[model samples]
Target chain A: MDFTIILQAGIASGTVLLFATLGELFSERAGVLNLGVEGMMLIGAMTAFSTTIATGNPWIGVLAAMLFAGLISQIHAFIVITLQADQVVSGLSLTFLGTGISLVLGEGLSKAGTVSLLPNFSIPLLTLIPIIGKIFFTDQSILVYIGYLLVPLSWYYINHTRPGLHLRAIGEYPSAADALGISVFRQRYFYVFVGGMLAGLAGATISLAVSPGWFSELTTGGQGWIAIGLVIFAQWDPIRAAVGAYAFGALRRLILDIQGPVLLLGFANPFYYNPYLGFFLQMLPYLFTVVVLVIGSREAMRKRIGAPAALGNPYVRGERGK
Target chain B: MKKFLQSEWMSRLIDALLPVFATLAALIIGAVMLLFLGVNPIVAYKALWDGAFGSGNAFAETLVKATPLLLVGLGICISFRGDVINIGGEGQMIIGGILATWIGLTFTGLPGWLAITLALLAGFLGGAIWGGIPGYLKAYFNVNEILSTVMMNAIAVQIMNFMMRGPMLDPIQAAKASKIPQTARLIEAFRLARWSPTRLHLGVLIAVILAILVYILLWRTTLGYRIRAVGMNPLASRYAGIKVPRYIVMSLLLSGAFAGLAGAIQVYGVNYRMITDGSASGFTGNAGFNGIVAALFGQLHPLWSIPASILFGALLVGANQMQRVVQVPSALITALNGLVVVFVVSSEFLRRRRQRQRLAHAKMDDAPPDKTSQPAEASA
Candidate 1:
């Protein structure tokens, strides 16, 4: 397997996880843990594919996917924020609801053949940087370019901006933030909406750019859950999240490629010899997620820094404690 | 009117009727979906109702379907009550099936009753081990149970796929060109007794008996009390001298055990062997996920889960008939199940608010008559 090609494809696929992991980070930072990312991504994938087929514009498909997924996310917001329901249950049900709605709406889209895909082109001067240029700036999907920009922007926004401070304050100490005139409920809802939109964008990136199609539940393939796990590993930091997402993307691509070759790095490849061993290869990403979570948890314990304090708890205006 | 609304009977009535209301709301939405699909809602629903209950045989099929759901629901009750969300039921069931199948295949010379018991026990042990890993992770390592369980489910699915296509492949099928993934037919002596003219098997009786046993466990026994106590308030339970982590682990272990039992029953009573279409849902029929809905619909009470499982079982079994008659995708049922869960959980807000109001009212009654009463706005 060629290293350059694998890394290139890996970056394109990594953009999907980047968007999803960042979305989940925003939601978790705002103290609303949405376990519905998988469902939302599926909805986004279905909408993007079907809308592009109808509108003949991949951009419109992306926009529609974001809008639809964002709208559905409001259900979780209303249940958890307005009604004070359990976040975990509401998130789980939201996933179910999202999956069901997408399945129903996406019924025939999988077999609808091809539509216009997102534009892909390389940057002029950036391509001259040798290995990094070939992997990062070479004819990549526009979404990949957008992902490159999102990482640092999100990091700066969360760390330096005034509103970013407010976001952190609400998540860490919502009751205190409420007393200081920040509308915790509204901000939580908005952040959850932002999270949903990003998830939709991730789904759109998949259907329109990376691996375009609506293949039912397999379209997202539990990447959403992996994103959630990534958020923990990143400790809610966007830059760290990008690194984890891209590495995971590369690993996922590697697993598929490893099974294809008859020989490995000048040795016999067992995966090629016994195709059944590929099943174990398929388990790596998920197993890696578990390992990542354990490491994140242990680090948090050591550092005494972890998830937002009020992450899974609903904010009541007159609550006694967080 | 206020007094009547505040009565104990009124609370019970609302508790009983809320799930019905949620189910109805979901069905109404599902009907609208059918309309969108270009099928007549009335015609579609008629097909669904008739398919679930039109004949004795159809009803038997519904019960047959409910068996696994009930078994899984029992586990849901145990885990959710212990405040552990065991989404790994899908994985636990597969591992359980694998173990039970192994037992059935190896110990063929034993008598029917003893062999079946040993196989079921093996199934429970396999599930417990599978489930206990996540439980142990959550309890000791501080990992999120939901994410871990989900990961475990994925791992279990791969393991199932590997087992069926690898070692567990029926020797005869392995020789064939098609190589369909399945184990050999379970020796007939080990199979659960089935009534003629219907697919109903003795597993249903076992499930019903387990439901009663679970109810007794949750209410009558100290172990049940400890599990519920941990769920209700782990900190308080710890302060009260309970081994919080141990119970957390036990709850998941027991929860997984029941799901494993369900998987064993499915093999010994329903399918007569382990098989797969290369996906967890293919073999488990999504019963692992559906059981969560049943548990919620039953108000998280073990005994109430019986009817809840049956109701969902009807929806699943009848969806096939609905699909045939109306040409609407059976996926509509999955969507409806999601809607029902959403509604059921959202309705909980109303119950909680009313409960708080009742407590406030009780406090008000104890106050002196001369003090004017103020409305408790905690409902907000």
Candidate 2:
């Protein structure tokens, strides 16, 4: 029950959430709410695992996962962007489609023993900074290191870059952006694809790096839904999303580990004595998501901050009121 | 031929047949998937068709499967019509089942009819509570109902797992080495009335009746009108003094109530005791999701959902037989269901485009100076 060990595993698992939350953030910021994160993640995990098994290369597996998930996302983009369908229903269907396709294709891949995993290494000097280095820079997966780079890079991209501003403009005011010669439809499609690729990356992170296997739907569990919840909690900011993802990842690790000990704080652990009680413990992540949503909603009310203005609305050129 | 294609009757015909085309397109894609799986698509489909409609008993089983879908679809009709998407059907159904099972188990001595009625009411109440929380959040706090409902589903799954393996585990089963997570057999007197030599029960009749009731509630009643009006445009409905938030909450509540009722019927009629395989879909058979497909196929009309449910129910029932006959995974039906939803929703744009074109054509003929007609093609 070393606290440092829990935090280390937490950071690794949190990378998975980081990818998913950031992906969803990009989609929602672009004014298209793609709720197909769960489905896309499943597709990613299946593709990554199956490809790694066949190709003997985890890097290729990761790329295939991202491409396949991104490709699947086009169905959603076409429906919501080009056809002007309800984003919610179309996204839900995408999830069903992704899950079904993966389940059918990844049917027996669960028993396909093991494959080469993504490289894990520690930074030379950073690992000497006591507690911070041990937890942050210790022997972690390459994807985890990439996650470290992505958070700051994403924050800078969305806030400082000209393209970032265009992304924001199209999401907040598509008509105005369209008038400025930025194709709202094209940008929306691209952002949605970016979201899907990130979601796929998150899935690949799980099967190839983090937990390193597929157990069907349980591979992602409800982490995709949690990432969606985190996006709201993060106020669509990459920094805030990263903080929330790491905290949630730690909480998940705590729940899983808490059940293993026979004694806790000088008393018997009820979870250990009665394994059924662990079911309630497993519910913490989902229940916490609901709680976080309430807090996010209330805070947004108090602060008067909110989602992108045009979020969830299909942007049609010449349409009134955008 | 162009003029004939543009005729009003032809447009009406196309509108009516759009869903059929979408379904056919999905099945075609499914056939391709079957081909990739190294199975003969025609033989597999024939086996599916025979399994679904081959015998009287099979048809009866299909009806039995349709019972839950129809019940859940009825709820989807109400919620979606109100513009409040209720993805919490799985959780709501589980909560409803827990309540209904508790009542049936506790009141074994009560009169059969009264016990059944009370259990059903309890189920409805449980689902309403589960659904109303998200509805209230969405209305007042501006929380996204989709995310909250999904979280609620996960929460509900844990609760169900807890109750089944702990409090609800049958005493006899608990003593065995393989302690299967299930409840005590619901008293025989309280079980749904089954038909002779068939699994069909009174639950089917109740589902059919409720569909008509939901139809009337949505179209013929003031309450129904307000729900639909709010769905169409909440701001306008609010300005018209419709109490927009209340209708939103009511729609979700009613929707959840229907799914809850389905849960009760499933225990009382089909299984006679609630059971679980440590997963939400294992207990629900994914009816909560399939019901959405049924409702969409029905054009969000409750009455239409009757046939839609039966159709999907046939697919589900026949998939089992197809799995056995062709060695193809039953997961194909789920994928096909997703494809249908995608196609059906995508086709809506085509329908709207056609309607807009017709209006533009009519205005051009009626009033040559109209300005709106010029931009119609550009917009399309």
DockQ category of candidate 1: medium
Candidate 2, residues A87-118: lDDT per residue as tens digits? 99999999989998988898888899999999
Please, what are the lDDT tens digits per residue for candidate 1 over residues A209-242? 9999888888998899899999999999999999
Which run of 10 residues does model 2 chain A get worst, by summed lDDT? A269-278
Assign candidate 2 its CAPRI class.
Answer: high
Chain A TM-score for predicted structure 1: 0.98
**Highest-lDDT candidate:** 2
Query: What does candidate 2's lDDT look like per residue over B1-380, in tens digits?
Result: 99999999999999999989998999999999999999999999998888888999889989999988999999999999999999888988899999999999998889999999999999889889888989998888888889898888888888888888899889999999998899999878998898869899999999999999999999999999999999999999999999999999999899888888888888888887888887889778988889988998999999989999998999999999999999988988989999999999999999999999999899868875766456645867
Using DockQ, give the best candidate's number: 2
Q: Which stretches of candidate 2 lie over 4 Å from their true place?
A: B368-380
Per-candidate DockQ values are: 0.79, 0.83
Name the regions of candidate 1 deviating beyond 4 angstroms: B371-380
Question: lDDT value for candidate 1?
Answer: 0.91
